[model samples]
Target: MLPPASQFRAQQKRLDQFEALTGIKTTYSYVPYGQLLDKITTEAVGGSSEYDLFSFQDSWMASLVGYLNPLDASIAADKLDMGRYPEVFREACIVGGKTYGLPIRAHPQLLFYRKDLLGEVGAKVPASWSDMVATAGAIQNKSGISGVALDYVKGSGFQNLWLWFNCLWGHGSDLFDAAGQPRFNDAAGVAGTQAYVDVLLKDKVANPGSSQFNEYDMVNSMAQGKSAMIMVWWWTYSVLTGDRSRLKPEQVGFAPMVRFNGGKSPTLATLMPFGISKQSRHKAAAWEYLKWVSNPDLEVEIVCDKSDPQTSDIVATQTATYLNDKVNAVNHGLHRVALESLKGARILPKLTIWPEVASVLETTISEIVAVGKPVKPSLDDAAAQVARIARRSGRHRS
Candidate 1:
């Protein structure tokens, strides 16, 4: 489990009820985000694990699947239909031909903008990247604030790659081809990368400090009224409208992520799923716990709960829950907006060495966006490095 222990704590509160209903006693342990991957992999390699179930990012499936119990039999036995989730979520939990886990948490990108600011400038919500730039520029000219705040800074998690990939996919380009060769240096790829960078340099509508901003910084920029718009994960709506923020709930508006004109619009999605350990002594009990925690009813309850601020979360993994009328009423229809975005969402490449590939992209984006490095040549260098990495790891097309 990652930080923001509040969500886990809330789930912990329901353990007694679960025990009463199913005679299954469960407990959860918290792990820091940075240390979790190593901890899970190390324990697995030692031929034992400290936990019966492992909660992890979807991208880690390639590395951890061998040590995980496939849930296909259990899923069929329990009559659990995986189709209830969106396509991206369903695919994220399956590797090769086996289902590994159930999605517990997921995030789709949304463009969060200031409603009052846009109204004042007579700008409608942007449906494309060009519209966003023009709208952002109009708001900036009128308000004297940066049009948008972006995360161009390098981070341990490679935050910059998250946004850049959306542009890449939007422009009909991808990080690799069907046979797993580097193609991000091709014409469409260079154009996509250039469009993303132009938000900060060419358009000049981006926050001046965006070169150093992380995801949290972009959210803070919205809370403080320093910027007019931010393209971020849907979960941030809770923080942006919470007690600490200066803006009112009515002031913030959200829409699906913008796309390149007439191109594919694929928003990046992050999914967290819990898998049963292959070495666990309590696979049945762990499956019970997984089902209970991921139940759509419980998800709707948590999203609608206003009693505890600590436990309040708007992220929903099930399509039914996102479209539920009750959930939409309380959440300002945020889940509905998220559902629209998830229609064309995409998960990261499920390669075991994605972390390394992300590192290459992070450096390339920083060099081009912050240091004014030439885009095409920098991307060419990155493609070459990635090709070498793939060849050495036996992941290349040849």
Candidate 2:
């Protein structure tokens, strides 16, 4: 399974060619990213006659396990040779003592900055939120563009949704505890976010269009020099810095996401995973394909190997060994520094109503920033709605 038509045809073609040469007939389906997960689940529940394996987000592992083939648990991880991939990436696939899916790819968010703009202002790259503000101001003072952009729109499924959450998360805030309580409604979380919003609406140091830009738009802005610095996942490095015609690769640089004034640098992780349907006639064959596509040789060569023209992304495994220390001499961070942030990174709050809860949070954020409501009251209402959604979702208790 893969993304819908326009974006997925190339992948389909690549797989089809591989199958024909190997004489291995395989079942594959393509759907829009928005509809893909639901279609995958529905096909699973009804029957896998039409589809075999399903692709899903990594964070949905727990949900996928209940329905999909317990692939690795059915087969030992060591037997599958987990050593070659990152350890943490392998661990993510194992749920309830069983392995579900092979990791496809992994790329953590990284900091981005423009050398020419920063040099003219003589201001250093911003790390702390306060510094981000100052840097934006300085950049604007010198360049006439907003300093920073944080997503304050509705719909948490988008990158800015996650970006906004990172702000609170980086400052030691979380949406919920393991007990699934609404901890993010606390004073610091609310107060910290208030400042976050004030920067966008009051200070206006962000792009007028940032509220609408997804992960790609931000990175593209940086490549075009519309914005000085963009905080995005590792893929941006490959995409933005690869072409000299667009922006010289040397003009861009990366660093770990910065620290808050009183906070340590946040290392954060989120997931995008895949799982098979409970209703697949081709579960075994699909698993076979997944194994091949996700094998270290393929993933590393296509994704992490910068020197290779096919190199596209970082490895999905969490282990440090998976990283290439000096691919084309890129300043790849070898440290497990992000491990702490991943540990601290908040997972989506437990709610079967996640789709709805995400919508409410996004709308509430839009109102706070777009409508100019008092940040705290808007948060209180959002927390209330989220609690209500939790009760409705039936996954969270008390």
Candidate 3:
């Protein structure tokens, strides 16, 4: 089995538990992020690999479809109900009318604020982007700290585009039209990009060095008391309330991602799916292990484990796990809030060339935010670049 570095420890613990419970032995391998995709591709193409199962990001499904074994037969034989997971997650696992993976971990964006700071300044939690900006400015003036922390840095690929996509969706625009042509250069797109840029360049509520910060940097800023609030993934709650953080659990608050006035609230979902490699010699045994590890009961237990006590990583794909009374009671209704957020959640475009498209978009945003390039021209250039790639790939028309 192969797992990424970020999930290695928890996966190791779960594997040990599985081994002890069933008297089965499973070997493990840890792969770093940059080398994971190449490793999977090379091993699968060679038709001889040592690893039986591997974990991958949702966006990679399209590119890796040829090398993965479809899980629909196994799921059917095992009598697992796909309906138990969210529709968006289920859709991500399916490519070309076949199920290739099972969703194990998912992330949705949330607004993490310092509850004590908001109360001290007499400001309510912001419900819209305009309110967020105004509230951030007020909080900054009243207390001498950066109002917000954002992942505005360049070259982070997709980290920058995640929040931008939320702004676009909130404003009733999308990265592409129904015809599969780029449409983010339209009026709503301009407004979304401008609003995001103004947060750092115009309103100045974020730290001056925000252009260098990614998800980790922004979360660390909030944990160290350097920023009053942040918009990031829900998994970071573990860090803010962990032993090393400066704040206590009671001081932090979570809310749905801010929406446009009278607009539906939407956030991006980061999903990690686990699949069995086609070249594995022990496909049947691997399938059994996958079912055991992804069981809803086991997931709930892992999310609410009392031994560590500081971790708040919620279950990714199962709805019942989040709705469980035991999970909600221990998490202070975090599961409930996450469920609400998922109502308007969306996954990234399932195109094989999404990585290239994301790189172009992130660069354009950097030019606008860091180099003072005008918004409309920058976005138009990005749209053109994406359209070129989409046309070349035969996935979309210009």
Candidate 4:
């Protein structure tokens, strides 16, 4: 689990409970996000892992598919209700018509802003990307703060590209066509890319340092009152309202991510699934652990636990966790807002070669943002590179 500090402690408590209830000893390891994919893949593919169960990002599904045990039989035998999970989250755990894992943590993007700043300027929450630019500008003019802080830092895998994808989707374009050919070099793609860049370069609304900012940096900027707004994962809500934060809870406001002027808003879902290793010698034991960890009741308890009583864990599975009144009352209705945002949420392309493809696109975006390269030529070159990768991987028939 790439847990926040509070969540890390909360998860530890749950693991202790799981061990006491089942008499199965459990140990936890914290792996940094940048190194997790390589570590999990290397150990699983080698068929001699130290761990029986592992959690992996949804985007790594296609690459790790070969080394994971299919959970269909286990789910059927246990009578687990897969229907309880959001379709977007449940679908992320499936590959080639088989269920490979269960989603334990799901995150959706949200536009978080300082309501006090917006109110002072008489600026409404932004409904479109253009509106966001205007609102941000208004807030900056009134407050003399950066209008937004975004995760634009390069080399952190796909965080930068995910923002670009939001813009791409909002413009009625995508990374690839149904035939799996690269399509992000088209006019819509160029427009989306330009809009994303202009937020920092031309509009001068986002923090200048945002060019090197990741999620944490953006969250810190908002929490410390350096920036007025940010579009980030839902989990950061805990940090913004937690005891360590510098701002009061009432200062922050949340909304779904911005869309194009006439387009429906679309947000990206980042899911983490728990899977049992195919090579595990203790398959049955591992299955039991997976079942316990994903049980809906347990999920609710973990998220709504009153130990802290202020911050809440964002559970990905189980509809009740998001809609239950008790849960929302404690967490300031974060779950309800997240559930609404999930209506427009989607996962990235499920391909084993996506990491490589994403790297190409990430570089293009960085070049455009950092060096002021023209969007068209950069996207064109990136499209060519991604098409080559797709062809090599047999994902692009054309």
- Note the Cα lDDT for every prediction shown: 0.88, 0.62, 0.82, 0.82
lDDT of 2 by residue, 1-398 (tens): 76542212334445775586555676556677778668766766675556667666666565556677777653464367766644555666666677777665455556677777778888776666677777888998788866665555555365545666666765566776677766666886786677667776777788776766666666677777677777766556656676632778777766566556464634455555566666677666666676666554444334333453442344444344334554323335522433433433434432345566667777877777777788778878888888877777675666
- Which 10 residues in a row give candidate 3 its minimum summed lDDT? 1-10
Backbone clash total for model 4 is 0
Regions of candidate 2 where Cα sits further than 4 Å from its true position: 4-23, 81-98, 242-246, 261-267, 304-322, 326-351
Q: How close is every model to the real structure, measured as TM-score?
A: 0.97, 0.82, 0.94, 0.93
Clashing pairs in 3: none
Candidate 3 segments whose C-alpha is farther than 4 A from its true place? 1-8, 16-24, 261-263, 309-312
Better of 1 and 2 by TM-score: 1
What is the clash count for each candidate, in the order shown? Answer: 0, 17, 0, 0
Q: Tell me how far the alpha carbon of residue 192 in candidate 4 is from the true structure, in angstroms, after superposition.
A: 1.3
> Residues 231-269, candidate 1, lDDT per residue (tens digit)?
989888887888889999999999987777553588899
Please provide, for model 3 over 37-77, each residue's C-alpha lDDT reduced to its tens digit, 9 standing for 90 to 100.
Answer: 77888888888668888888888889988888899999999
Q: State the local distance difference test value for candidate 1.
A: 0.88
Q: Candidate 4 residues 1-398, lDDT tens each?
A: 24233444566667877787788877767777678888887887677767787788888889888888999999999998998888889999999999999888888878898989999999888877888899999999988999998777778766788788888888778988888888998899898888888899899999888888877888999888899998878888877877878889999899876766464657788888888888888888888888887877777777777566433466556677889897888777888888877875899888889889988988888778888899999999999999999898888886
Q: Which candidate number maximizes lDDT?
A: 1
Deviation of model 3 at 331, angstroms: 2.2
Worst 10 residues of 4 by lDDT: 1-10
